[model samples]
Every structure is written in C-alpha cells, then in structure tokens.
Target chain A: MYASRTTQFIVGLFALLGIAALAILSFRLGKISILPTPGYVIYANFDNISGLKPGDEVDIAGVRIGKVLGASLSDNQARVAMEIDKGVQIDNDAIASILSMGIIGGKYVSIQLGGGDKTLSNGDIIRQTQSAFVLENAIGQFINNIGQSGGSKDSSSSQDSQQSQQKK
Target chain B: MQVVEFIERVGAYILDSILALGNFALFLIRSLMYAVLPPYKLRLTLRQIRIIGAESLMLIVLISTFTGMVLGLQGYHTLHLFGAEDSLGTLVGLALVRELGPVLAALMIAARAGSAMAAELGSMQASEQIDALTVMAINPVQYLVSPRMIAGVVSFPILTVIFNVIGIWAGYAVGCGLLGASGGAYFNNLAANMSRHDVALTLYKALVFGVVVMSVCCYKGYHAKRMATGVSRATTEAVVLSSVLVLAWDYFMGSILL
Candidate 1:
C-alpha cells in the first residue's frame, strides 16, 4: 500500500528531522563529545573534596580549561585526576583549590597560576592544593571557641567573688 | 460446599491469568524472532514509520512545549521559595530529559498511533485478511507485526529527543522570558548538572517503552476474536494495557538504572 511518491519523500524528511533532533540533544544540550578533546591529564590531592564530582569543571582564574576525570583515595587523601586542554600550561607550583559556584551550587577546581618557571606536564601531581571549605566544620569550631570562652569567664567571675568574700 | 466452590473459582482465575501471560510471552518472542530474521520488509517498515512516527510528530511537539512551559512556571515558583529561582533551567532540563520527556511522549504515542495500530490490526483480523495472508503462503507475523514493531523501536527515541529539546527551550522561554530569572544561571546550572548518563537514560527508557507499547498492542489485536464486537474490545484493551505497561516498565527501569 506504499504507492505515493509524496509519502516516501515525507518519510525521508521525517527521518532526517528526527536524526537532526537527536544530534542536537546529544551534542548541544547534553554536551557529549564523540572524540575526547585533546588534553593532558594531571593529578591533585585534596584532604576533602566536599561535594565535588568527577564531571565538575577545572578552571584557571574563572576560565574553564578542562574537566575532572575522576577521584580516588591515595595516601589518605583524595587524589583527583583532571584532564586539562593541551594549550593551557599549568605551572609546577600552581595552587589548586576546590571552589563552589555559588551559595548552594556545585564545586569546581580552580587553579591559581604560580610564578615558577617550569610548567607541569602530563601525569604531574600538583603539590599545593586546598581542600573544599566545609561549612559545618567552621560552625563547629566557632561554637567550641564560644563555649570555652564562656566557661573561662564564668570561672574568673566566681574566683573574683570568692576573693572579695575572703577579704571581707 | 460454597467455600470449596469459591476457592475453586479463585484457583481457576489465577491459572487463567498465568496462561494468558504465557501466551503473551510466546507471541512477543515469535514477533522478535521474525523482526531479527533476514528478508527484511524495508518498504512496509517505512510505511509503518510514516504512519507511527511522522503522523505523531505534531502532537508530540505541542504536548512537549506545554509540558515544558508548565515545568518552568512551577519550578520557578517552588525554587523561588528558597530564593533559588536561577535553578529553574536545571529543574526543567533534568525533569524533562531524565523523566517526563520519554514517559509523556510514549504515553501520547500510545494513545495516538498505538490505538490506531490495535484498531487497524483488530479489524484486519476480524475481516479474514490475516487468514488470507496465511493461506497465501506469507507469514502474517513477519509481514504485518514485525514492521510495526520496527517502526515503534525507531520512532520512540527520536520523538523523545524532540520532546526534550523543545521542552527545555519552552521552559527557558517561560522561566527566563516571563519570570525574569537570569538566563545565564538557568543555562549554566543545566549544563553543569546534566551529564551523558542522564541523556542515555532518556533514550534507554524510550527504547523500552517503545517495545512495551508495540508488543502489548500487537498481541491484543493479533489474537482478537473473529467478530465486530471482538475488534472493538481488542482495541480498547490494547490501548489500556500498553499505556499501563509503559508506565509500569518505566518504574522498573528507573530503579534499575538509578
């Protein structure tokens, strides 16, 4: 029952349209690359990665240069493997820090370019790295300090009252 | 005696359902075997694609756009409560690409093309056309069922991709255009949060839903009783069963994939 040429043409058109839509979803929206971008791998060790994930961005001074490939435990620290684009050269003494995108956003690795003359090559480990800031840890430390100071003040006030009573 | 009769009736009902399930499994396996075998009916498959895929395109586009727009509106209001309106894009994108796009598109196609498949095949069975094909030394399953199955498997993912793309853009139009959320944050969060895994999930769900829809609809119609009332009943059963199967399979896949 497939007699009409018009139907055949429309079918072909529809197939092409579907393929085009798939291409857009895969490449544009999904950001999937068939061929991995030409890049070199480097390693950085952090004490805590916080909420940083493997697919998070690796940036140099607010400019995204690559992506985090994966993270694993190495020598009691989080060893993160990052794929940096070939053109961008990271200095040997550069500092890598985990920075959040916003108040309630994802974490990314940011590199502060170092003044060292030698540049890091593939497989080089960045020695200077900063771990992600844990908000809970900071709050806990603050509360502990407050508690200690309050207890010490109360003890000193009691000691002063006892001395006055003894003198009287 | 009355209690024994009731127990016997329940046992018979359970056995009847088990037999029906076995029949469905065998029918699906036979159709799949025909689909993969050589001497592929490319012309008939194309015709089925034109009917199932091309005809449903406009309906998919319209439904997806509205769905996206609604997601954007709802997401903005909800996230705005936490002062996270900028995440509207991420919410819309993830919701559509991961879940709504495939499921909703499958349901729509099930309602539109799936019902048509059932009614057409049911009527054909009632009219003795299927018998005539069998008598003419042609395998009715291969000639009729395989092509439609192939069409469904091909069409579902394509329609889902179209749904996701259009839906996300429509969400952007509502969230950024109407709600005045920062366009950059919306898109940036989407890009940052979404991954290849999410996109793959969308396509996978579409593929499974496609198979479920085609098998259920075709099975019901193929075994339809030889009567006018039987054809109508088969059509109704096919639509309801396929839609329900699509949803049920979606839940299973989601849990497994996650």
Candidate 2:
C-alpha cells in the first residue's frame, strides 16, 4: 500500500512538470513579447456593416495590412474604428469596402488605395464606402426577381442543369 | 396522434435542458463550498496529475501533429483557389490555437484519462472499497475527487501547449518542406497574420476544458451505485457527457469571447 502511494505521487510530479514545460514552449511560439506600434485610430461610418466585427482583418487591395479595432453604433450609423500600420500610406480617394472573407466566410474591411499623391491625415473620414454583400441576401433578391419576371420563361434552371450535365 | 407525439417530444427536450442546467448549478455550488473548506490534499493532487497528465501525453501529442497537418493540407487546398496559399499558417494558427488545441486536448484526455478515472472509481465503489475507506476514516471525496480536479486544471494548459506545438510544426513541415513553400515566405505570412490575442484565447479554452473534464468524470464515478451493471453506464455517461459539453461550450465561448 505504501509503495503504491509513493509511486503514484512521483508519477504525478513528473506529469505536472511535463505539462508546465510544454506550456512554456507554446507560449514562446506565440511570441507575445512582440508588440505592435500604435497607429492613428479613425472611424468609418456606414449604414450597414453586415457581419464585420472587431478584430476582423483589414487589407490594402489584396494584401492584409491591419485589423478593425473597435465597433459601435452612433447616430443611426455603424461606427467602425481601424488601426493600420504606420508604413501604409492611405490616399485621399481610398475606398473601404466591407468584404466577406470568402464565398462563405466572415466579414472584414477591405481598403483600396488609389494612385493619388495626397495622403490621408488623422481623423480624416473616407466618404466612399460599400457594405458587405451577403450570399443569402443576394439569393433572396434573385428569387424575387425571377418571380417578378414569371412570364418571360427564361428557362435559366434548365439551361444550368444542361450545362452541369455537359461538364460531367 | 402525430401532434401529441410532437408536443411530447418538445416537452421532453425542455425538461432535459432544465435538468442539465439544474445539475450544473448544483455542481457549481458544491464545488465552491468544497474550495473554501479544503484540507488541501496535496498527495492526491499529485497522483491525479500523473494519471491525467503524464499518462495522456502520448495521445495528446499524436492528436496535435495530425490535426496541424490536416488543417494545413485542407486549408491549402481551399486557399489555393484564391492564390492565398501563403496564409496557411494564419489558418493553422487561428484554428489550432483558438479552437482545435483546447478541444482536441480535452477530447483525447476524456477518452483516455477521464474514462479511466471514472471506471476506476466506479469499480471500487462496486467492490465496497469506498465503504472500507469510510470505515477507516479516510474521506472518499478528497481521496477520489480533489486530486483529479487539481490534475485536470494543472495539466490541461500543458497538454494544450503540446497540442499547439505539434500542430504548428506539422503544418510548417508539410507547407514548407514537402509543398516547396519558401520557409521565409511561409513564416513571414504566418507572423503577419496571427496575433497574441489568439494564443491567449487558446489558453483560456484549456483552463475551462480542464474544469469540465474532471467534474464530469468525478461526478459520474462518485455517484455510481451498482459496480457491475451501473459502473459501465456511469463511465460511458461521463465520457459522452464531457465530450458533448466541451463541444457545446466551444460555441458559447466563441460567441462571448470572440
């Protein structure tokens, strides 16, 4: 009985130590020590944000360069705050779009920087913006459109089926 | 008849949810009370760490590496269509660290350590070992539950780390080594995409999972009545319930935390 207890105790200690060691390794890999330099926090007001939320990715053209920092509702408009890196120079006519991650992914802010030489300053608003287009919403609109054009007899579904079969 | 059956089904579902919530609430109160009035069973805690932590290491490691490689392969396949193959690290990091790390670790431990603990305790109860301990003045709760709880809490973080490490390396190996991705390019893209917040979220998952695993296993084990017939049911219940709770909590936690 005494021997069994001692063995159990020793094994437990060894296991605890192993766990701690593994935890330290994972923490190091995450590299939490590297801190980002603070950049200007500016708000983008839009009528709709779709699925966009805080911590979503922000991109310049197709390259991801920053993240959405804060989100709130103010004066009937959705206010979104973004923190872009200092290195990225935003032009005066840059457009920000609420982008869906993929065909069916999360929503994020996408920035399209134009060739204008002038740079945007702190607190300057980018007036040109577009909200995210949800696939479900698009499908709803398509169905509604199809119903309205009932007499046309487009036969779009039959054509689609025929095309699919040909491909197969 | 069909309408009545549907109503009955709905009623049963509601009652089951209510019962589960009530049981959880009662468990919380009991655990809280026990926390303040502890003899602090150090020896038992150590033993539990051995069984749950040490014994389960191999399984955790195996699961982690496989998970990482699979994530990279599938992520690459999908991301390639968009010419975003470089961001495989980002997907691996975000998915593994935030969700998979903790969930897989909990599932592995539940299958290995959790079920074993429940079965061991249940068998002892059936054989009257618990009664013998009671007669000898050894508190069964401390000898049985406390160590397992402490072990689960302590080792879960460690297991989580192992899970993440194996997964990340496996992903890098496949994505960079075999797939011919430039190591520098892959790592750079990985770093650019992942954030410190993701890692912190992963660790938080581990902590919660530890609590869930030990509580479910111990609850089933301690409450078991008939050793031969009832013990198997108890053990099965503990494993299934812990597994389900881990997944269910993942959804709720993501909604709240993310």
Q: Which has the greatest lDDT?
A: 1
Q: What is the lDDT of residue A124 in candidate 2?
A: 73
Clashes of 2: 0
Q: Residue B249 in candidate 1 has what lDDT?
A: 83
Best by DockQ: 1
Q: What is the lDDT of residue B206 in candidate 1?
A: 93
- Quote the positional error of residue A137 for candidate 1 in Å: 1.0
State, as a TM-score between 0 and 1, how close model 2 is to the true structure.
0.64
lDDT of 1 by residue, A1-168 (tens): 672676688789888888898788777766667796788999988878989987788889777688888999988888999999889999987889898765666788999998878999999988888778767766665576577765776555543432211111
The sequence of per-residue lDDT tens digits that candidate 2 reaches over residues A113-139 is: 767678876677666666666667667
The global C-alpha lDDT for each of the candidates, from Candidate 1 onward, is 0.86, 0.74
**What residue runs in model 1 are displaced by over 4 Å at the alpha carbon?**
A1-3, A150-168
Model 2 chain B lowest lDDT segment of ten: B184-193
Candidate 1 residue B123 Cα shift, in angstroms, is 1.3
**Model 2 pairs in collision:** none
Chain B TM, every candidate: 0.98, 0.88
